[model samples]
Target chain A: MSDDRIGVRKTYKLAIGGAFPRSESGRTYVVRAADGGFLANAARASRKDVRDAVVAARKAQVGWAAATAYNRGQVVYRIAEMLEDRRAQFVEAVEAGEGVDARAAGALVDAAVDRLVWYAGWADKVAQVAGSSNPVAGPYFNFSLPEPTGVVGIAAPQESSLLGLVSVVAPAIVTGNATVVVASELRPLPGVTLAEVLATSDLPGGVVNLLTGSLVEVGPVLAAHRDVDALDLCGVPAELVTELEQLAAGSVKRVLRPPAAALDWRERPTPHRMLAFVETKTVWHPVGV
Target chain B: MNWEYAPAPESRAIVDLQPSYGLFIDGEFVDPGDGSAFKTVNPATEEVLAEVAAAGPADVDRAVEAARRAQHETWGPMSGAERAKYLFRVARILQERSRELAVLESLDNGKPIRESRDIDVPLSAAYFFYYAGWADKLEYAGFGPSPQPIGVAGQIIPWNFPLLMAAWKLAPALAAGNTSVLKPAETTPLTALVLAEIFQEAGLPPGVVNVVTGAGATGAALVAHPGVAKIAFTGSTDVGKGIQRELAGTGKRLTLELGGKGANIVFEDAPLDQAIEGIVNGIYFNQGHVCCAGSRLLVQESIAELVVEKLKARLQTLRLGDPLDKNTDIGAINSPVQLEKITELAAAGVAEGAERWTSPCALPEHGFWFPPTIFTDVSPSHRIAREEIFGPVLSVLTFRTPEEAVMKANNTPYGLSAGIWTEKGSRILWMAQQLRAGVVWANTFNRFDPTSPFGGYRESGFGREGGRHGLEAYLDV
Candidate 1:
């Protein structure tokens, strides 16, 4: 049975430099629903596209990292609000992509937004919680602050598309590092949709760039990127993890090792995740008259 | 004003330099299996202070095994408060014998006695005391509720400040319940061996802390040892890189406090006289052997001539001679290798057409000595401006505005430290944000505290030492 009225389909594209664009390669892949029905085409992100995303992310990192913590917190919080506004869209996308029941998909969307909110709150407080006024044995003022590790490249988790992607992206960017996220292999529609939400929020362009493509193609390109200061290999396919980790060491890039298996995206998040991508800076000034 | 002061040498009476020394392992002085021995000399006098055993792979293996057994059997299982008492005892004993250690350090490392007494020894003891209190409070250290220590730590220290670096590495490692096998610099292992005696006297577990002294091969063996879970190295960038390459696939945790060519930026509105003092302290302190020494000076173009004049005047007042002299402003270079590096870099500055001005002080003929020197009309691309000379040399560059000053200051790859001299508080804060250094000194320079986390950015290496950050490197989190 078909309805007389045809619905307007949304165009799915890669997010780079704050704009949605079709792949520079003019390539697209069929994204079928769980029932094998036709869905929107997802952009096939090329290696060049990932490089461009890294360039864009690097261009925006210093400004984003320089923003006041309170301002960054408010902007991140605004993203949660936008996600809340588009709540129905994510639930549908998750349900269609992952074959999840409506209730389970709804829980995923709620957790994603809540995760954004939680990371939003962390933006203003991570330094205080992690930093300290060192009781150094001298007449000097000493303090250590947790600073962002510049541009980060993340391989989004393959299993929990929305919640897992948000989990990795939010903690890294919440502390002021710009990110280039390679969406999940099996499921990416929810993540791409989340990118649309990030575009509309007050976040600056290139703060987070999303690319949808084959993990094998786009993952190693970012891992070897010279400008990318850190790599979170949480979603790298099993056989590729060791090679990527080894290549990452050429630049001495800070690495977050991939978990043994997919993490439970529904698990509560903590600040320990944020710490992996921060550099502690100690400042000392003489207490002179 | 011209009358020379009488010889004010600090007596080496209190320290009884042993004829020959053995490695301190498992609370016992043990001979190296290789039967090879090396002499540690006084750079100020070229006199062999003592002979030390050279540890080979077998010795490092033995030490690592001891530390592993101790961590599992004794030190690692001890309560934090109980550990705190042991550290407190070490700190007290250090204070009780700081004078003797200071003389030994000056005789061995060739740094002036006043600095050894005032800066190095006191700071070392202070660090032990500071981290002692932290032993019982790891739960609140931001890693986790019960952050567990990462087992045996293999530490390699530099000749510049051997004992201080040892304290920086060991205090926090012990505070977090880790056992250690420390390797002091080849030329300066006396104070570290002395501290090993203090550890035994404090009733610490036999195998908890071991001092294995030798050169590069010994340190390489320690780094390659499989039993060690962590490595803390304070040395040159080249050595740090080799260490980093060695641990690539091993998953060994490492923290490197490496080389730096820090910049001291002075604005036109800065207090002129105080800025001069800061400039002297920045480059001349510790004979400029400091890793975070402000070797580059960025002065405003409008006041560049005045700053150079004042700096030269201050340099003239600097006393250079015996490191044991209580009043010596600068001491002998640590070794002949270090002196050659300084001589080569200073000659490079002259060849590059920078105007050179060295203090009118005669160097001793027998030992390695370098007078306080500065080069003006320096371009950022010059070797003197870019390299870590690790000696008493300053490269002066001028900028017309605050923006230009920041641009010049951050041009280097090393970000270990930076100094900003400005009367305007807002301007200082603004510059602090722009400077890429790990430690930003607003108006003062060459200041260090155990509470301050110290390290670098870019090729200057990774991880921090000291403060809460120091504890994190030793903990599993």
Candidate 2:
């Protein structure tokens, strides 16, 4: 496993457009290991950082979305490959943060990688699986296609830090929607490391912008932000969900209310679709023209 | 809203609805293959309402086969626009004959006239109208390209809201292009039978929507019917479990809206007067026959006595009598059996040391009736507190802290709906998060809209009805 000491922290900044820069907020929050050891301080993304991520996402999304579903599938597959390559680092991070056994961490890492592959496989086929044509009366050719809801803000699950973050973010991005993921409060190292993988993979910058901070601090900000069209509240605290729901209600943004029970990260496949995260615009032109 | 006697409409002896009613199947009313029939009593008068057909295994088979035949060619291949027009016709006829439907619903099902008129009829129309819109918009509802209908749906509706339940179950199934074999509860079969007439009048294809009647045996048969591809039931938790167990090995899709013992919490800071009104409506609505009725009341300890005082005063204003009366607030128990159950549970509450109080309301001698009941000094572990009595009964428990209120509110296994009464927006938000119930009503209770998802948790059941989520129940995900 490559150690953090080997890579070393050069600068703490927001990773936008595949480069690191100080957050527009010029603020940082220190992350710590479960044992109270200090991890690196992560950038506190401001509204500007969110917008920058959105801009980068807007730039990359067209090309990424226009890429053949099969090619998009391959890019997602690359993410899984990189994740599997760094399996040991993830295992170690989960062990240090969650205080779990090496055996469980190993299984979690395998499951997380397997989840990535599962979603990657669906990148090309979700359109076929979830969209449909209706038996319209006239020759107008009415059909429904699942589209990405656009820029989503996710509060990752606290317990299964990396895997939970991946599960939520993968579905949004694989469906062609960009995301800003708020990493787990108690465990943040694995999340940042996973971000590093996304930076190197074919996944364009701003497709996923990872943040590490107190959920209470950034959750409402992201939920209330108008630019984010949806909120994937997979791991929010029960006491805060209603507030987030109220905030999300302001813009009528879609909110996938958090699951009542904690996630069983190992068993379920995270489904991802290019269409689920983006809207389809069907243009009609006369055949003669 | 005090209980007042209204004479039954001059006998209607001239219009003798046949003593024996048959299952309305394959576009015509027919006797069940099994020669069984159960007598339904008018809960208000204890008179034999009618002898309703008790469907058995053979009857279920016949209905399923009929639906299967319809789905194969007649209904299944119809264009969405054509089906939408049929639904629009049905919706129109429903509005045209809503008064008749509402009167029968109140008479046979024992819900108050106001609710039957204001809620049941309108909601039924809204359901058909809502689903009617979806019929043309099916391709846009997110089912895969070339999404096809799952064949026959075997639906079992509860007694409480007979026609509304049927509307809820059938509207989506039909809109999604599936035929159905629906079994309304034994006690309330009239409205569903009338609905069959409406379907026929709308020129709906024969066997498209078959209405059968019976109790648990019939429901079991419908659930086990192999020809049916999906089962949608709205009933008790016990019956829901039986259906779940029966469908375990079979790959048939199932959606059950089961029992609930929801919490109605009132904080000290709430508008006490409005909270009191919400409390009465929560527990006393429809004789508390509602699945999402707020049966448990958790008051802040300091305000418990004050709330109880206000509740008793409000209870006086709740009228109880003939369900057909527009002014009636509470109505007769659906049946003698249900009334007996409520009485037995209330007796148990008293015997178990809780203070049982009933409003000073007069009761008629013949029919099944229960005054709005409230029990104080109740513990969370009490049977009355935990069990779904499905009657006009409320159990009062007190909490000290915000955390304690949340703990008490979510302690029950059922999670269908809950009510919160507080002025602080932050407190409402905090409490809404902590509560596990599916639909949380702030400062209100027993309110429903077609756009909101409604269901429950734990033993209460799974799968939502209404909203975008409701589409998932009918669609193959």
Model number with the top TM-score: 1
- Candidate 1: what lDDT? 0.89
Candidate 2 deviant stretches above 4 angstroms: A1-289, B1-16
Clashing pairs in 1: none
Tens-place lDDT digits, model 1, residues B50-111: 99999999999999999999999999999999999999999999999999999999999999
- Using DockQ as the measure, the top candidate is 1
Instruction: Mark the 10 consecutive residues where model 1 chain B has the least summed lDDT.
Output: B241-250
Per-residue lDDT tens digits for candidate 2, residues B214-292, read 9888888888888989988898877776676566435577776888999998999998988998898898888999999
Query: What tens digits encode model 1's per-residue C-alpha lDDT throughout A244-287?
Result: 76666555577787875667888998787798888877766667
lDDT of 2: 0.77
User: Taking chain A of candidate 1, what TM-score results?
Assistant: 0.96
Off by over 4 Å in 1: A1-12, A22-50, A135-140, A214-224, A237-252, A260-262, A286-289, B1-3
**Candidate 1 local lDDT, residue B62:** 91
